[model samples]
Target: MKQAFLTALVCSTICSLGAPLKVKGLRTESATNPIGVSNSPRLSWQLDSEERGNFQRAYEILAATTQEKLDEEKADLWATKKQQGAAKLLVSWQGKPLKKGQKVHWKVRVWDKQDRPSGWSKIATFVVGEQAKLLKPGRISGFESSSEKLNQLYRQSIANLEKRLDAFTEGDVAALGDGSAVHRSARAFLYHFDSVPHLTEWLRLMDSEITKDNFFPIYPGAQTTAPVSSDSGVLVTHPLWWMSGDAQPTRSRWDAYEGHIIAREAQDTLLKGTKWGGIADSENVAAEFIDLCYLGFSCRLILELALPAVQPQKAIRFQVYASRIRKSFERQFVNKDGSLKSKSQTGHVLALRSAVLNPEQKAKVLADLIALVTKNGSKVGPIGAHFLPGVLSLTGNQDLALKSLTSLNAEEQKNYTESGIAEWLMTFVAGIDTIAPGFNQVIISPRIPSNDSLSWVRAYHDSPTGQISVYWKKLSPDSALKAEVMIPTGALSRVILPIRKNQKITESGNEIADAKGVEIIERKDGKVSLITQSGKYSFLIK
Candidate 1:
């Protein structure tokens, strides 16, 4: 009897200890109940257990438009019935197509290694966004390059940015000091991939934070008296307006902030003069570089705004204020030999990008920048790092840019924002850029390195109109170059092909001039520029 009782107690204890795993931390698209989720959202959840060696062997997910349906296991939306895999993250939504503004309720259950099933997790929900249709299964922008390291970096950067989107709050992005700046800097790249609804939502939140004093906080929702950088508001609003072609939201905010900007300009208080002219943030050299860049960028934007007849005088006056800041910058920062007084990489990059340097100064600055990057290898802080790769490519040092980019260690790469890396790869490496807002017109000028370090590249971006793709490769070690381009319907592209001495260009066995949907715009400076309508075209330069 005693032996039997002992045996029964052991059996009961074993059964009790082997309870099912509990599910928690349910997420969709790396967010907890996110608003504006993608149509085909990625689902994820965490597993909890007390037993040692407990591991998930399989999972089941049920999604519905209503909680009642999900509770009844109706799965009116999607049901992954007994999926056999260890994958618990980013499981693609395979149910019905999610509509805009529709709330999707989803829950999950997992089986342990011993095949014991867990209870269904609490149902989580995510609302579909208007632009959710733009997101595809994998990456928004397709990228592959000669260097596998760069290709991996491209993928990792895109993933990081998607994850960062989860940090969006009611009033701030990531709730960091430079959250607005990140949003502003990321606008163009996001638009390149046709990802804009989240940015639009962020802009709306920022607009609401603008007080009657016309003061936008440097850190939204933070207790601080410091004013935002001069260009923050316009930088975010103007590009969003151009990309989305939605005028009302941008126009209304512009109208509200215009008076404050003008008042500051009139008072010459847009920035404060320090050893470095008009340092917007006195925190560090990185912050100072960012501030100066913003001032210069804001000036350029005002000049662009002045080109139109609407409020020309105000725009002109702003330009004048901008000129004063430019002169101050040049006087304080540029040395006699055109070298920067400070040997900071961020400062050099921003100086070139902000249009503060004259042609001669720019040439000298470019040389200096190359030398600096070669020595340090992208040692800038978060803010400065954003502009480094793009600037390096723009100055015809793609080799150096690639070197700096691929040389980043895992931790160093993590420190850099996804926007900078993605923008550089898409805009410079693949060379697909917008000549007009909303990608109505594009420029396909792939910059191949003169050296053998990089041999081929292929990339595509889904624009608002349609998908624009480009692929280019060298036919031989020192021979001809071949390029393939895809222009979407209702869009125009300017395809620029580099020409070497004694090389002839042809399209599909004929001269490029005779190709359909192709119009030669100009042949200058060793490049033949052709305007192409929506179609695929292959070119050979030999």
Candidate 2:
């Protein structure tokens, strides 16, 4: 009896000392049991351990066509016996090439620092298909307008963006071209369609490449590497924070690098570019022009949104630096006639979109842009074209923006490998925009064309929280308008309706003042603006 007790105690102690780790958050290609995954998708998971100072020493993965096979340890598909490393993300599948629409069940286990093995993780299943590779539009987000040409343009733009998606690994997604512009444009497309999982994963991959000096590589996930002189991966953090409504990612990055380091790096880049007469070492005037705009814009964002909370002094310094760059931009690029010295469509568009230009200068630049487009059409390249429509609309020329949009020929539209068209259609034409990050607040002010070119517009965006949609029809030119809007739960919207001469606005046949879940903020600038909570609303103006 004494010997048995001693043996039992020893066994219990050994079991207790085993690694207290379990695998969780299993994902294939950054999605949980995602459908339409690649034939050879990458697997990833997180380790949960109650014990401190425990880290993964090695891992093993088992994949099979059926759960029973995995349960029985058959591993018909593939079995990575034990990969002796600490890689917990984007581990490639090696067993066999999965067929289209094939379902795969996978599980993983890991050994700890002391070589104590963890139990098997929960099984995750992914469906194999070619479609999984593309960043397609969400089911809840779509666009439709009276003009078929405009509708087709939106669809084609999405397709173009998808074609530009190049995977570094079997499951990793990155933009095809090098430079900040391509990746930034791709990210905007993903955000607009609410491709959260893909975007999050892509950002993670980009973040992993951020050097200790806070420099993001010009070409992510590529063998050839160089530091990006302009705002690339870092600048996209602002939109990601807003779209995800999660500040942790942004906060953590800044924390890792610290605000002062980031500010200093930016300042150095600016100084280096001063020699080249721009913010980056580019001989092309248009490239330099866009780089200057991006750098100044990124610095301004950091100064306003990121640094003040943690490093107030750094924020002040950043503001001064940004101000100097802005002044220098105008001095070097802007001609006496208010047109850019380069006389390129790209230069003008970048100038207009950037905060570097004041209102008067922007007006002059806008006039020049309109004239250039009017005379030559949209001669802007892929990068500059991304911001063209939005800039035009923000300058209060939505009509001109729409005209430029619909006038694009097939070949010209095909060259636009960015999300600009889709973004413009959703934000300007349908007029559904997020006032706060993650669609906690939105603005719905559809720019119904004053002319009869477009009779109606309908669109929706599935935000991280829920779906927000808007539809409007012109009952008659300058006579009556009908609009229907859906605000997701837990979100607020500010609706702006254009008030015609002596027109009265009513909701559900009742005065706007008496409508439920609606609050009249004001009537200003020939428009009625009202705030509303989550629900569907219909308005008529006659």
Candidate 3:
């Protein structure tokens, strides 16, 4: 709950300027070396620099269970070979068994853009505590106890925004206060969780603040409309407007330019002989078009989740609207080869993420998306970067997703981006996601790919029902993939464990025999699925 500043360490004097390259600001959070958690914590560091555009090209980290091991220049726990990427923060930990309450000592060194190597960072330490200690205040088993801890994070995030709801006045809406649409926090809660505590009230307030014109002003004052031209549309209030802060024109300028693009192309075939005007502008027409498409995508995701529970009748209306926009988006943006007209990373990723592509088009689009990133040397701008991991996982490319998410540089500091990547590590790649909001029912399906850089994972999610934990290991190609799961009381889980071809699964050194609340669903295509209820399970796939 309390935040601490990251500690910086001075490196050996190796730079041309004769100053030591300082690795500064190393505060570990939930994703990094968590104070008390089941899963392995990640590590991140920042370089203190005065040079213009200085950045890290690669880095290596070493960790030990004790200071003695670390001082001996040995990685008793783990040592990362130099990893090539700009990402210096939230690097996943791959080390020996880290038990609860064991202190971790670690240090890092980096290679700069000029190919100069920095000296090892000063040793830093973090006390390990149980997630249950933080959440339930009791001694409990591993990752399962951490689920409540993770859930509390979401709750806290929502509570923080709930207190600020009143500050978003009509003027704040027009100005796009805090770089997002006023309803961003509310929408985030709606999208991720099953429901919020005060759903109806939250929606009502959001609706009242965002008017039909969708223009967000810094200060609404007494005027109902933004001072800018009426041509402004949803672009004026897009949540991601701040991402393009580097764009030469301000929000108003981009909105006006987008309006011009729509009006000018109203008669084009892509425009369908209709004048659909008003949107956000970007570096290119395709980027601008994708921005509009993203708006429709956001609406679709929201309505898809919110409608059935709250507004049943409005379902058809929202679906129709979302469908029409999606079709326009696909027709205009998605090319025949499954590439975006813009060929931009964000455009392609959104095409997949926003559900603009049909099921049949997903494969091609995915391939193109991967190529786009690889072709560009794995560098994506801010807006599209955050979506990459989820997009990859949803497309059955967990291996690639993990690779992409960890591939980072010092430049990335976005809160949402970091958290999204962390979620992937904790849930999908680590093999745990709540099928039900509040994690009443979970799907424990670990996707430890053959080429995975990680050897093992231990993670937990505290659910409404109880704590769910999973510890998995794929020691080697010849060895069986082992898994241990702890299911909470009153909760049910669909466990889909991975297996090699021609391999069978065993539990307790024997074939997995069905028991009460444990039914073998099926075993085919290198996977075994089981319907499990409320118990601890250990299995080996060989």
Model 1, 1-542: lDDT tens digits are: 99999999999998866677778767665456777776877776766655433567889999898999998999998888998876664577889988889998889998987888999999998999853322222235788888988788777766666555544533235432344455435653473343455565555555567655565545445333232342455566666655544444544565645654664454446454322323354324544445555566666765554433255666766667677777767777789888788777877877787767788888898888899889879877665677788787776777888888778887768656454577777888898888876566788998788777788999888665446789999888557999998875445689987887788888877886677668788887888888887667888999
Tens-digit lDDT string for candidate 2 (119-199): 999999999876554344344468889998888887876665555543432454445455455444544454354355555
Q: Which stretches in model 1 have alpha-carbon errors above 4 Å?
A: 1-139, 167-177, 188-194, 225-231, 263-271, 274-290, 305-309, 417-419
**What clash count goes with each model?**
0, 0, 23
Candidate with better lDDT, 1 vs 3: 1
Error of 2 at 343 (Å): 1.9
Candidate 3 per-residue lDDT, tens place, 382-480, comes to 446446666776767766665554454445424333233334445566677666543446789877766746577776654333456889887565767
On the 0 to 100 scale, the lDDT of residue 197 in model 3 is: 19
Compared with the true structure, all predictions reach lDDT values of 0.68, 0.68, 0.52
Name the TM-score of candidate 2.
0.70
Write the candidate numbers in order of decreasing TM-score: 2, 1, 3
| Each prediction's RMSD to truth | 16.8, 14.9, 21.7
In angstroms, how far off is 112's CA in candidate 1?
A: 58
Best-to-worst ranking by lDDT: 2, 1, 3
Q: What is the TM-score (0 to 1) of candidate 1? A: 0.69
